[model samples]
Target: MYLLSKALIFPPVTEADDDGLLAIGGDLSVERLILAYNSGIFPWFNQGEPIIWYSPSQRMVLFPNELKISKSMRQIIRKGTFSITFNRHFKEVISNCKQMYRPGQGGTWITDEMEQAYIELHKKGIAKSVEVWQNNSLVGGLYGIDLGHVFCGESMFSKVSNASKMAFIYLVQKLEKENYKLIDCQVYNNHLASLGAKEISRDSFINYLNKV
Candidate 1:
């Protein structure tokens, strides 16, 4: 693994391990974080662990045109069961994401430092959030980096049964209307697969980021 220094540089994605861990020991400065996303790399490490960068050989992504909304989700959206807003409550959304429990995960990868870093990114308009509300109360939301034509999704959380899905669907429809090219999911999971997110070659994903 590469040990990053003051220089904001990263080893090639090809150098990543079988599990997609590319490098370690980089600080989460704004400059480094921006550069990382632009180059198809992202940091994912639990608290007490040195910041770890990854560029998986297979990247999970959702092209706006391919977003899948099931009948149940469509019905929920049409009913306006939840209200959606953009960049309205980023800190709250991320903080909730940090506290959310994930299956097979012992703790959050959104460390305190990571939270502060992304919060700063949000202030700069590089990071954005989608909030889902019910009965005037915040229920679910998601946060990610916005690369103009592509959104690099970091994490999401749900307090209700379909709150997170509502946030995601709303975000996808909005992005589609805005002519976005893709949503970078970072990794594959059944949750995303059901939404039509699929894996693509890292090289192909990088090329898309470069072009858009």
Candidate 2:
């Protein structure tokens, strides 16, 4: 699944074309990208390439009420050593996300182009961010799109232990306070599962989207 998702397939996607692939060679213009987010598609190509779109068979998501802040994480939160804020230095957040060293990972798909495109989205207020600071330095952050009540999470990174978890915890709490219904996490992986994100079949996910 990751292999297929990591490459441009044969056919390009049509506008709001949720079928197989969405436009393979499109630019990540704020207009196109925002449209994609609203329609459950997103660009995920590497550096020095035209944007490509994806609509997976299942969507991984977490309900605001479903966030599982583990006991250790709860302890971390109680420590109160980290400060979090919204829409703060979004480009810096993306850059910091790209630099994270994932164990057994070869490259980051965040890309220079995607970073700049999201920066433009941030400028347009279509994208929002959550940043975590520790000891006067950025230690964690995440960026995503806001479509009315649904927030489509793009990506996140942490420079310190438990930092990204802290950001996710805060996001769930904030959304719960605001009455937001869903955080569309986009795909399934072990990391997200541990944080309470779960897989819904594509049909069920789209049905949830309809509700949102």
Candidate 3:
């Protein structure tokens, strides 16, 4: 593992440890965050810990064409019960994500500093958010780093059942229309798997990142 200095650089992803921890102690400046996502590395640590960077050997990703929408989700979409918007209410979306309680997790990885950092990224138009609303109230949403051809998904949350899925489905459809190569889900989980996201070798993922 490596320790990051003030310099805007990261060790090669190849040096990451078995758990994908590549480095620690980096600041989350907008420039560094942009470079990190473009290079296929991202920060993921709790609030009290030193900033940890990871480049997992197995990457979770979804090709826009491969996104799966279940029958119930499709029905909900057709009913027009939820509305979706991009880059709208970003801060709110992320705030909800920060406070959201996961099944087994005790704390959130989206620290206050991390929140401010990504907000800066949003100001620069490098990061984006998708908001899901029901009757003008924000219920679910997602946020990520947009690298043109490849979107590095950071996190998402839903207040109502399937609200986040609605946001995701919309984002995928939009990206597909724009010919995006893939959505980088970072690590794997059953939730993403159900949506057709699968693990690809880090090498393969880096290849996608290298696409011009």
Model 2 / residue 66 / CA error / Å:
0.8
What local distance difference test score does each model get?
Answer: 0.94, 0.78, 0.94
Tens-digit lDDT track of model 2 for 174-193: 98899888889987889889
Q: In model 1, which runs have C-alpha deviations exceeding 4 angstroms?
A: none
Worst 10 residues of 1 by lDDT: 1-10
Candidate 2, poorest ten consecutive residues by summed lDDT: 1-10
RMSD in angstroms between candidate 2 and the native structure over all alpha carbons: 4.9
Which of 1 and 2 is ahead in lDDT? 1
Writing each residue's lDDT as its tens digit, candidate 1 over 1-212 gives 78888788999988999888899987899999999999999999989888899989999999999999999988988898999899999999999999999989989989999999999999999999999999999999999999999999999999999999988988998999999989999999999999999999999999999986
TM-score of every prediction relative to native: 0.98, 0.86, 0.99
Reference-based TM-score, model 3: 0.99
What C-alpha lDDT, on a 0 to 100 scale, does residue 106 get in candidate 2? 78
Q: Name the runs in model 2 displaced over 4 angstroms.
A: 1-22
The CA lDDT at 88 in model 3 is: 77
